[model samples]
Target: MKVAIIHDWLVSYGGAEKVLEEQLALFPQADIYTLLHKLGSQSPLIESKQIRTSGLQRLPIGDHRKLIALMPYAAEQFDLTSYDLVLSNTFAIVHGVISTPDQLHMAYVNRTMRYAWDTYHQDLAAFGVGGGIKRLAASLGYHYLRLWDLAAFQRPDLVLANSPFSAQRLQKYYHREAQILFAPVDTEQFAPAETRDDYYVTVGRLVPLKGIDLMVKAFTTSGRRLIVIGDGPQLDELRAMAGPNIEFTGKLSSPQVAEILSRARGYLAMAEEDFGIANVEALASGTPVIAWGQGGVRHTVQHGKNGWLFAKRSSESLNAAVEQFERLDWLSPQLIAQSAQQFSGAAYRASLRQQINSALQRREQEN
Candidate 1:
């Protein structure tokens, strides 16, 4: 098969990039297309691919920062007609890539554009873009993008949702059904350790969307040691707000993160993620999670079994859950690790291969 993979942008090696890496492994011959790329910013596995960037790559705004307006148009310009199958690992505009009627276009969506939908107000508030000419401009831009986004949703032959949290939104917003395929965790790479540590750990982008502020406030009140192991635009602000009890590790290698997870008392998930990959990674390391009881966490975390889930999205709610968690007996490390196996790389590969083959067969029958 002549396969092609389209990604929103290759800025950093985050969750979406991890999924792209797996897709590359599955289709080694596939040429990759993206809106922009920051060389050496992602894994070597991704950097080595035959990646082609769009016209937006030349923009002065590095990595497409503050330039969402042109993404849909830029993405639609990719000429993917030569390929038989196009697999898009998109969190942004790459889903709108133009495909010939003969080509199969499938998108693995993390979630619909949050800046244009559910988290619109929250994003604006977080970025201090509320009520002004700036807000008016942002509103108009998002309004245009929302229209484009909705139309783009129909272009893909199949939409694969990373979690039910994402699938529900796709159904609600686009009136489209997506095949559920949870993003994989490399279980083999993260081994369980019997020994544990007193300090809790949380790993993800240190951003407003991640609710790092909530975690800092909760841990400050509880006086619990929290080791945050990631860095982003919100790094400086988050560091300033964090108490002495919180230790910011900036960023770490995968091995370092796995080692930290293996030794952590538990992983704290403050964000309402579409798919909480870190929660599963924590389970893989035999570390239980203390997550906000919403979004993807509800699907992964089994309250009082694998880990504790706080009811509300506030610091007070998280603090109460921490107190309750301290009262519980020690959990079985083996069971927690076993729970993560279902979302392993092997499982994702099998499911993805089956789905792609089925889709191909259906196309053949139709032709």
Candidate 2:
């Protein structure tokens, strides 16, 4: 089979990139088509592939807002006629890649664009784009993008959702059904440490959507130690808002993050993730995850079992959960790590392979 893989962009190595790496392993000979690529920014497996970039790659990198307007047009430009099967791994527009009726095009989508939909108002507020002319212009712009996003979401022959949370949104916004294919974590890299640490850790981009501010407020209120890992636009702001108890690591190597996670007293997650891969990685490292009980983390973090879940998205609720988590002494780190085995890379690949096999067999029979 002449396979091709379409990915949104290769700026950072996160859950989507991990899934793309697995897709590369699954289809070693497949050519890669992406909107942009920060060459050598990915795992060796991805770097070794034949990468083809869109015209937008010429612009400044990192999924910038200026680029979003052009993405749908750029994505539609990928010539996929020769390929028998095309797999698009995206959190963005590559799912719109054009394909022939004779071809099989499937997309492993991790999220529905929040800026254009559910979190539109919140995102506008975060960016300081608001009321009067600014809001109207921004809303008008995203309104058109949302229209295109809806149409692009339906272009794929099959849609694979990264988590049940995302699957529901795909169904609700786009009126499309998606098979849930949980994103994976590299359990081998995130093994438990010999000893636990006193400080709690939170890992993810520093963004309003990530609820880092909420974590900062809670930890600051209690004067508890919090190690914030990863960086983004909110880094400086979060640092300014944080008390002495909160420490920002900016960004770290994967091994470094794993080392930190393995020894942490627990992982703090406030965002309602589509799948929460970092939470699973923390769990794999034998660290309990204290998260807001919403989205996909609810599926992983059981209240008072592996970790505690705050009922609300507020700092007060998170603070209460943290206090409650400290009193619980029975949750075993080893058991928590074992439960995360289901999200390991090997298991993800196996399940995805089976799903693809069934699709291919059916296609062959139809032909």
Candidate 3:
């Protein structure tokens, strides 16, 4: 079968990119299509593939990260009829691709568009598109994108949601049902450490939405030490504002992150994540997590078992949770490592292949 994979962009490697890699492994002959492709700036897995891009590639903005802003307009360009099977790993625009009856379009969604509406207005406002005008533009953009996002749901023969929270959102926002498949976690690469070091660890982009600020505040106020991994727009200002107990370790190699996760006393996740890959990584490292009870963290972290979930998404709630962590016995390394196996790469691949096969069989029967 001629399989075609679609993704929003190839600017940076993250959880979505990891899902794309797994799809490629399942269908080695697949062709990849995207709205934008940054030649040397993707995961090694993506860089190794032959990728095709949309007309947006012609724009100067395509060479830089700013092209993400053009995605609402960029999505209208895809035509998927040429492929026999279409698998879209979409966090944004690739879902807008049009498909034929003969072609099966399966979408693996990370989350609904975060920047276009209710989620990240403050981040969008920073672009200098002020007040009423920004709100008006964003409103119109959300209307158009919502139509586009819902339309993709119709094209897809099946949808795979990365988390239960995402599955619920797909039903709520798009009014579409989806199968739940947690994103893969490479347990082999992130093995449990023999002994943990004293500091706490947190990983992910340094963005306002990520709520790293909450973790920094909670850890600092409670006199706990923390090492933060990853970087973003909020990095500099956050570093300046953070107390001495918190250390910001910009972006690091995967091995470096694994090493840090291995030795940490516990992982601190403050974001309202769609599904947290780092949370699993911490569990694989035999480190329990103290995470805010929101979004996918509810699905991934089992409170007081594998990790503790903060009842609220605030510094006080997180601080109180950390205090509670101090009271409980650190979970056995063997049990923590065992919990990580639930999200292993092998399990993800098997479940995805099974779903794809089922979708294909149903499509054939319909024909």
Please report the candidate that would top TM-score against the real structure. 1
Q: Lowest summed-lDDT stretch of 10 residues in model 3?
A: 61-70
Kindly report which residue stretches of model 1 are placed more than 4 angstroms away from their true locations once superposed: none
- In candidate 3, the residue pairs with backbone N, CA or C atoms under 3 Å apart (3 or more residues apart, or in different chains) clash, namely none
TM-score of each model, in listed order: 0.97, 0.96, 0.93
Candidate 2 least-lDDT 10 residues: 59-68
lDDT by residue for model 3 over 1-367, one digit each (tens)?
A: 8889998888877778877877888888889988888788777778988998888888866355456556756666676678888888888877767777777888898877766544656656655566697678766766776676677666677888999999888888778899999999888888777777789999988877778888877777887899999988898888877889889889899899999998888998887788988899889888898888888988878888889987788989988888898899866977888888988888999998889889889877877
Q: Tens digits of per-residue lDDT for model 1 on 316-344?
A: 98888888888898568888899899999
Q: Please, what's the RMSD in Å of model 3?
A: 2.1
Over 4 Å off, model 3:
62-73, 117-130
TM-score of 1: 0.97
Instruction: Rank all candidate structures by their TM-score, best first, as comma-separated numbers.
Output: 1, 2, 3
Whole-model lDDT for model 2 versus the true structure? 0.87
lDDT of 2 by residue, 1-367 (tens): 8999998888777778888877777788999999888888888889888899998988755555667788899999999999999998889788889999888888888777877899888788878896899888888889999999998887888889988899999989999999988888778787888888899999888878889899999899999999999999888889898999889998899889999999999899988889899999999999999999889998877778888888789999988988888888845778889989998888888988888888888888988
